[model samples]
Target: MQDHIVVLTGAGISAESGLSTFRDNGGLWEQHSVYDVATPEAFARNQELVLRFYNDRRRQLASAQPNRAHQLLAELEQRYRVTVVTQNVDDLHERGGASNVIHLHGELTKARSSKYPELVYDIGYRDINPGDTCDRGAQLRPHIVWFGEEVPMLDKAAEVVRTADHLLIVGTSLQVYPAAGLVYEVDRDVPITVIDPGEPASVSRARFIRKGAVEGVAEWVAHYL
Candidate 1:
């Protein structure tokens, strides 16, 4: 079997593609507070506001193209079994030509029934309005893991990390919970490389490349054994 390379990505990867991150400042998401747009309570309180916010984000994501870092990581599939565990909601990785992606937070191209989390559908770049409904007539919401919700894919992500022969973490500061905890699941001997601006919390044994995603990842992967 080909050696596995588990890649953990965060907003910092997409930042190179011109996408903005929500955590750069305290809880403010696109000028709105996290409580105003990223939580179930917010969605429950103002569905229209939440829908509009995501609609704007979906539109921006539609215009955003995959950057060099995204493309390079996808290209790694030629020599190794590459699996991407992304905290980002965008589809840049898939658009960059990578197969085998696991969205740890959720995906922006999908909509799930408010009543049944299992009922999810591909929404592409379309806007979900107030009248949108699922098969059971339940309202449709973004298929995202919000602030107060549980991460359904965390276990699978942990499993993937545990099986990896190599690990690459890009763009994330390793501050996000549950996802951050995943690094601890890696076998101590597995080598890790972190590429980001801020200081990422230390993993088992990491090689830090403090630069933007494209430059840093390109530099490292160039001579990767």
Candidate 2:
């Protein structure tokens, strides 16, 4: 049986591909908080604003290419059963040759009906305008797991982690809750490895690679070759 390798990725992984984090916008707009743009309350306040925000993000994602870390993980599928659980909403993993990927925060390339979340459609890199509606006649919202929204795939991710023979954590600070808890869910005997430039907040079991995601994952995977 092929060893199951589960990789947990965060914004750091996508950052290497030039994906911008919401850390600072330099007051270019109205100085809206990240929560102001990512929460249900925000969407309720301005539907067009929310839709436009996601539309731009989807477009930006379309222009990004998956980095070395992403492609290497895909190659690992040949040697072991690989499952990628990423906090990123971009589709770069699939484009980078990874066969199986779980988007913990949902996907930017999809939209769903406001009345029925199950009625999701792959919108690709298209903009999701306020006028877009589902079959139910409700406005289409980004399929993202927004702030204060439940992460629908949390349980599924934990289940995948529980089965891992080897675990790799990349580009995450382990500050995000629930997803961060996945580290504790792995079997005690399972070996864990973490690759990040900064010191991770809390990952006691894994061996550390103090480098950027692409360089770190590449270095670590090389040892196995």
Candidate 3:
């Protein structure tokens, strides 16, 4: 059997594809505080603003091409069992040819029913208007794991991490809760590598490559693949 290689990615990886990171503008996105546009309360108070924010993000994602870092990880599948667990909402990893991916923060290209989380649809960069309704006649919301909302995929991600023969964390600072805690799930004996320009405090035992995603991943591929 091919050795399982679990990869944990964040906004840093997608940033190379021209997508902006969440904390780029001093904890603001598009001049709005995260709480103003990325929380369940924000959606409840002003659905129009919240929808508009995600609509813009969807358009940005549509224009972004997967960068070399994303492609390198996909190429690793030829020799290893690769599974990507990404905090990014964009589809760059999939576009880069990764067949197996778990979106921890939800997907920008999809929408879910306000009433039923299971009722999701692929909207694919289409603007979600205020009145856009789901199949059950409820308003459709961005399928994002907004602040104050439980992450539905957290358990599955931990399980995936536990099975990793090797773990690679790219482009994340490991500051976010739940997701940051995943690195602890790997067995102590498993090899861990962290590739990012900034140091992630959580993974002290990991071999750190202090470089941007594209450069860092390239260095990793040269040594491993």
Candidate 4:
């Protein structure tokens, strides 16, 4: 068995395949505010609007493909104990062949009961419309962990980071909390490699690859691995 390897991914990785970011240079989504669509209050106020936003996301995910970075990460699984802790809701990491993945934000291909967190269902190609109810007569909601929702996987992700021998950070601003704090959980001695176009704020000293996800990651991995 190889030493532990932990990877953290975010929207930038998926953006390589043409997916949109939540905020891009003061984009519409930023102005619209995630609070209006990504909060429990928003959903409670207008379920239809919330459902449509996710439906649009789901459809976009259907058309997007994994990029070179995703492929390279998956290839690492062959020789290393790779654990992907992603903030992204997409399945590209898995689609590109990564074996062990923990999605902190929840998955788009799944839905959970509004009344019960454990009652989750996989709805690969189906649309989640209003009034869709679970067996217990509870409404079904998107599996996403909204802004105010507790990130259940955060503790598990921290444990993964603590055991890692090496850390790979890809395509995130390191601004989002909890998920971003995971970098601090890594053993101080462990080496870190951050691949991104911009300078990232890392917990420890990190070797920066100043390029976008696809181009930078493929070239860097080829040189290092």
Measured by TM-score, how close is model 1 to the native structure?
A: 0.97
Report the lDDT of model 3 for residue 131: 90
* Tens digits of per-residue lDDT for model 4, 46-146: 89988888888888888989888899999988878999999999889989999999999999989999898899999874789998988898889899999
lDDT scores of the candidates, listed in order:
0.92, 0.88, 0.92, 0.87
TM-score of 4: 0.95
- TM-scores, all candidates, are 0.97, 0.95, 0.97, 0.95
Error of 4 at 76 (Å): 0.8
The predicted structure with the larger lDDT, 2 or 3, is: 3
* Model 2 spans with C-alpha error above 4 angstroms: 23-31
Worst 10 residues of 1 by lDDT: 22-31
Estimate, for each residue in 75-180, the C-alpha lDDT of model 3 and write its tens digit: 9999999999999999999999999999999999999999999999999989999899998899999999998889999999999999999999999989998999
Residue runs of model 4 more than 4 Å from their true location after superposition: 26-28
lDDT of 2 by residue, 1-225 (tens): 999999999988888998876532442134556656788898889888888888888878988999999999999988999999999899989999999999999999899998899999999999988778999899899999988999999999999999999999998888888789999999999999999888687677679999998999899889855
Could you tell me the lDDT of residue 83 within candidate 4?
97
Candidate 2: residue pairs that collide = none
